[model samples]
Target: MTTILVTGGTGTLGRLVTERLRADGHEVRVLSRHSRPYAVDLRAGGAGLDAALAGVETVVHCASTPRGGDEQAARNLLAAAGRAGVDHLVYISIVGVDRVPFGYYRAKFAVERLVEESGLGWTVLRATQFHDLVVTLFEGLSKPPVMAVPAGVADQPVEVGEVAERLAELALSAPAGRVPDMAGPEVRPLDSLARAFLRATGRRRPVLRVPLLGKAYRAFREGGHLAPERAVGKVGFEEYLARRFGPDGGR
Candidate 1:
């Protein structure tokens, strides 16, 4: 069995990836800021990172923060991986990092570059937004009496479990740089998704579409973040809601 290290191993996607790898008989190291044994902080130049990489053949980098510092974390990881002689480095990124002008997307794109030029065997998979993120967005939007959503914006929300499964598969295989994007089964409007959340939560609110200023908003409105052709994910938003909230809307 191969020895693999999964950064952010306690996170939503990382947790699943770690589980799959361990279940497949691979020795998995879970690295996080708070996780024991391998609790190294990547953002702080990843002290104690080299120890975690010892005998690790592969690495699945799932640790990222939308709040910032992702680029530094990636650089630290790449440096440590190179020093540890890691055979493969796998990264998960967003599909529209190139097309979208958002700050978080820009950081993700930067990390992608770092992985590519690190001189280590690497693979990168760009996926559409996860269902959990969409749910979080909707939960915040539904808080007010009138839910405000971006006008003409749509999201393709993929299942986190499916992404984790794919990452596990890639970790076991040879490094293939920049694979095809993974997207949800449908490209749905933001307002529609908000409505779905409202239905599932048994909440009634008027969904209002608001046109915001800036290039990033325009990019989103123009579908810069969608992957229509790569709609390979099996779970749709409605089905996800059904499973999460139950048939009776969890009422």
Candidate 2:
């Protein structure tokens, strides 16, 4: 069995990936800031990272912060992986990172570049936004009396479990650089998704579609973050909501 290390093993996607790898009979190590035995802070030069990488054949880099510090973490991981002689480095990225002008997307795109040129065997999978993220956004927007959503924006929210499954499969196979984009079954508008959340949560709120002025919003409106051609995901947002909130809108 291959020895694999998952960087954000406790996170939404990383946790599932780690479980999948271990279920497949591979030795899996979880490395997080607070995880035991290998609790190394990846953002700050990743001290003690060498110990974590020792004897590791593959690394699934799922540790990322939307606030900042992703590029630094990636650099530290790459350096450590190189020193440890890691066979493969798998990275997960967002689909619209290159097309969107958002700061977080820009940072993700930078990490993608680092993985490509790290001189190690690597694979990168760019997926659409996860359902959980969409739910979080809707939750935040729904807090106020009127939910204001960006006008004309659309998203294909893929299942995190499906993404984790794919990552596990990739980790076991040879490194194939930049595999096909994984997207949800439907390309849904933001307002529609917001409405779906309202229905699921049993909340009544007026949804406002405001046309925000920005390149990032423009890209979102133009569907830069969507992959209609690569809609390989089986689960849709409504089904996800049903599973998460139950039938009858979880009331």
Candidate 3:
């Protein structure tokens, strides 16, 4: 019954969130950089943004930049949403942004802080890296026969589909400030995940873990990226892989 605007609607997560909302009989409008039949970029602020948000009851913001440099734009989005009187703002963030030194994470953290201070009804869920991100990260980085990762790191990779469902559920509820974090069913070594990913893709590789020093590696190695008791996702690493590499993995 509500009209919601979904940022980054063309992306992996945004698409699923929009689909779920639509299925629930809610009106779904997606914002993106390139205008599509169902997309618009919310970054371009002004009356234009106000117009885009007109009559919108909720804004599920998933739009973000490549690994780094998008903090200001994120701020702009939040401000514009407030100006438009958006009822709820749901932001998807990464796990360990607090402890990690990664530039992208800093941006996520900044926006999360902004949302908290804005006094808007808001929910921010810090999630572990996506299982799909694992595959994407290692796709061309692995040296074919050798899987390489920053050494001593651990991660709990959850599925994007799971994230989508959670976002949909959160969109319908009052802002929980921050939702119970979500992650995969099991925790796995970074090297193991890389190896599993390569193997799932039918690629032969010996995964190599290269040591990295920094808050990023330190936090990751110290288990900054797992949500064991908070996992609400249904797909496990193996299950995700089967969808991508099992005999029927090829669609």
Between the candidate structures 2 and 3, which one is better when assessed by lDDT? 2
Give the lowest summed-lDDT range of ten residues in model 1.
Answer: 39-48
lDDT of 1 by residue, 1-251 (tens): 99999999999999999999999999999999999999999998655899999889999999999999999999889999999999999999999999999999999999999999999999999999999899998888888899999999999999999999999999999999999999999999999999999999899999999989999999998999999999999999999999999989998
**Tens-digit lDDT track for model 2 on 139-168?**
999999999999988889999999999999
RMSD of each: 0.8, 0.9, 2.1
Candidate 3 lDDT trough over 10 residues, lowest sum: 35-44
Q: Mind giving the per-residue lDDT tens digits that candidate 3 earns over 120-239?
A: 899998888887888778887775566678888777888898899999999999888987788877888878877777666777777777887776778778886667787766788877
By TM-score, is 1 or 3 better? 1
Residue 46 of model 3 has an lDDT of 60
Clashing pairs in 1: none
Report lDDT per candidate.
Answer: 0.95, 0.94, 0.81
Q: Candidates sorted by lDDT, descending order?
A: 1, 2, 3
lDDT of 2 at 218: 85
